[model samples]
Target chain A: MSMTMTQKILADHAGLKEVSAGQLIEAKLDVVMANDITGPMALPIFKQMADHVFDKDKVVLVPDHFTPNKDMKSAENSKAIREFSREQCLTHYMEQGKCGVEHAILPEQGIVVAGECIIGADSHTCTYGALGAFSTGVGTTDIATGMATGELWFKVPSAIKFVLKGELQPYVSGKDVILHIIGRIGVDGALYKSMEFTGDGVASLTMDDRFTICNMAIEAGAKNGIFPVDEITREYMQKHSKKVYKEYQADEDAEYDEVIEIDLSKITPTVAFPHLPGNAHTMEEINESEKIYIDQVVIGSCTNGRLSDLRKAAQILKGKKVADTVRVMVIPATQKIFVECIREGLAEIFVEAGCAFNTPSCGPCMGGHMGVMAKGEKCVSTTNRNFVGRMGDTEALIYLASPEVAAASAIAGYIADPRKAGN
Target chain B: MKAKGTVLKYGDNVDTDVIIPARYLNSFDAKELASHAMVDIDPTFTQRLKPGDIMVAGKNFGCGSSREHAPLALKTAGVSCVIAQSFARIFYRNSLNIGFAILECPEAAKDIDEGDQVEVDFDAGVIKNLTKDKKYQAQPFPEFLQKMIQANGLVNYVNQKREGKL
Candidate 1:
């Protein structure tokens, strides 16, 4: 049977000759992950099922969501997971000071690699598919099961093929590409399906761009988003990971539910308006309407907090001061990336530009801390989701955009096109 | 298996954030979580929600975040089951893992109105709207899922398997 990349990987892990869409199979997991919030929730269930995890090395715990102890409650929750990790002697537990967002650090630390089946207790776990892994999010109960027995059930997903052509225009990054796709397909466009990206245009995207694209696959309700392993992927793996990785390619006859063609060059710097990621509009469309103002700008998150994302923001913010009316917060995804930003003087640029450069945390992205909005406020953020009440009061609004747009908006106090904004 | 309840309807993309906002996720107590369930969308959800109530919504229900707290919140708040036109992938698995009942039926989801009395027959894959005097068909759970529900949840099922009682 001819199988797609996701199917081939699942079949190999399941010890099956072949599998098809919607077929249920129990497959071995290469990695099982949870963060502070879900980690503590799964402990009691994990204890009830088994005294020890199936494999300590295979289990990873990162305290990120409300880290730096947002409050007394978050502090206690962090302690619970900390103690649990120490008790289990888990191989991949990251302490608060040393940790980053789960999705960002996992790939950066070489914990998740190609041709692996990984599950995390966070929706953005699909981010690893950028590295050619079959990864998806699960609940606390699923995490408990995975910890107790390094295996979990899966329903193989049918796929949607996105064929890309042409190179992206300047100021357009992977965030725009994904936001454009999500807007076109609506939030649930790829529900219960795998989004497989291919075409020569793939070669033009940096690894950071691919990671950004795959990170928000969940925003479109995709089970996962994957790219075929290429020279760029191999190079990234060689730099970060010591684990030998395997590569899988879809057969020529691989069945796809639908095929969508995307012209990367035509994708302008895009933004998803209030409420839904599917409410996407390009800068041209947005500029033609009444100018939308904002009270705050957040230029970081797992979605666009990588090195390239930071560089883009810093380049635009170097000499420009943010609007006196808007508050700008820039957060790196991990501790390592944070230090690298400072070393590269991007930190200096942000501070001199009157922006608050924060430590690595998912803060403000999920409205946990750092920059929660007030009632009747508006924000342009580089995070993935902009659901109602995501950042603060239900009345407040969120506009999802690329780092370039976010940085520019911080200066203009309204959503602005980066290319046209004064430097 | 069967469930009966009055419906509480919502529109499309009823996301996890609104179902159980991230601000309240610091607590693991099911009751504490339940107290705030759907508060973002309806500030009076906890007060209005009665035991054995059914929550109904339009397309792409539970669209954001993989926080199982969404399902746990609804289940603990006495939501007997949820009927939606469709559900996000992670939310679907999370519901079943916790033994929460959910059905996908476009006709019922579209026709069912707030405060309508609804009855679901899981074995027969039928949803009866008593208030509307209508019946709609939904896909039944597969054998494994049916067994998991019978065991009360995945935790119990795993325990039974470990003891060779499966």
Candidate 2:
């Protein structure tokens, strides 16, 4: 019997000859992670189980959400991880200056590798699947168990193959593609299934685009979203990855529970309206009928906060000023991305375009702190998960879009297509 | 283990942000998190829910962030268990790891109504609606997971294993 990439990785880790979807197997984890908020909670549970980590090198703790000590409580929360890392002598503890978001930094620092099984306490752990790793999110207690035992059980998930065809239209990025897919497939469409990207269109996507796609897989209730490693992935690995990894792919005969075909050229800059990522609309659809105004435009997060995303946004924002009524904030996903932005003068461009530049953090993406929304305010954000009250007041609305659309919308003070925005 | 509760029904794709909201996640206290549970969707949720109530929901319940806060809030708010047609993968594991009861039964989820009196027998893996006089078979927990929950969460379960007490 042929197996998908997910099955092959799980079978190897579990030391089984073969495994199928829905089969429960205990597998060793290559990397275990938790962010500040979840890590602090897991610490007490970890203490209850054991005083030390099972493998310090394998355990990674980073404080991205509410980091840099947003408040006394947040400071205390981060303090827990800091103390635990010191006590355990963990090798991968990312301090404030060293850390960005967990998802971006993990791969950037070569902590998350290809063909490995990773479990993070945060849900976006699926982001690493872009690198061909079998990664999933767990809760605090699950992190505690993984920390103590370095192993956890998984019920292998079936695969959903998304075959992409045609070239992406101008400014129609991976965010638009993912939002479009999520719109077609309801929020629960891929429940407990892997959404695997394939075909020529996927090959045309950059690693940044693939990361943006996989990062939002959770919005469609997918266990993980993955892309096969190709030359682009190998190039990315050469620069950032510390260790060599074996490339993994699904067999041509591998069975998929469902197959979805998407034409990239048919998609345009899209936005997920208030309340859900599934309520997606192309810019043309909204421009045709809706009269919407925006209060803020946030361009960042694990979804679209990489250097490539920043450069794309910069391309749209250069020599243009944001609308007087709308505030724009651009945050890099990782410090490395921020440094690269500075090196490339993207920071200067954003500031010249009247956008506020923030240090790398989850920031307004989680609504935990920084650039929070007010009641009745509307925001176009380049982040995943637009559920109500996500960015601030429950009355405030969030629109999920690509960084290009977000930047274009910032200039227009409402939802606008990047193609029409004066570049 | 057996439990009984009144049902509080929710709709599909009830995500974590609405479950606890990110604004209130600054604190690590479960009780504090419980105070604001479901307020975004139903402001009177905490006030209306009685202790040991059961939450019945449509498919893909808990389908957003992997924050344990969602399950922690429900459990802290005295929800004994959540019965749904399906659940988001992480949320399902989070609920089990926290020792909160969650049963997936499509028929029960479809048939159960709000304010229904429900009883669950974990050993028998069955959910009975006393108000409707209906019984639905639930997927039984595997032996290992059952032991983990029996030990009152993964923490205790792992502790026992380390000490050879399991």
> Which number leads on lDDT?
1
**DockQ for each candidate?**
0.89, 0.84
Question: In candidate 1, which residue pairs clash?
Answer: none
List, in order, the clash count of every candidate structure.
0, 0
Interface RMSD, all candidates in order, equals 0.7, 1.1
Here, model 1's chain A TM-score works out at: 0.99
Candidate 1 residue A59 Cα shift, in angstroms, is 0.5
lDDT tens readout by residue for model 1, A328-379: 9999998898899989999999999999999888999988999999899999
Q: What does the lDDT come to for candidate 1?
A: 0.93
Residues A1-423, candidate 2, lDDT per residue (tens digit)?
A: 788888888898999988988888889999999998899999888877777889988999999999767889988889889999999999999987766988889988988878989999988899999988898888888998899899987888899999999889888899999999999998988889998888888788888888889998888898888888888888888888788687788989899999889999999888999889999898889889866889999998989999889999999999899999999989998989998999999999999989999988999998987799999999999989788889999899999999999998998988888998865
Q: Which candidate number would show the highest TM-score if scored against the true structure?
A: 1
Write one digit per residue (lDDT tens) for candidate 1, span B1-166.
Answer: 7899889999999999999999999998999999999999899988988899999999999998989999999999999999999999889999999999999998899999999999999879899999989999998788888888889888998899889998
> Candidate 2, which segments miss by more than 4 Å at Cα?
B162-166
lDDT of each prediction vs. the true structure?
Answer: 0.93, 0.89
lDDT of 1 at A251: 90
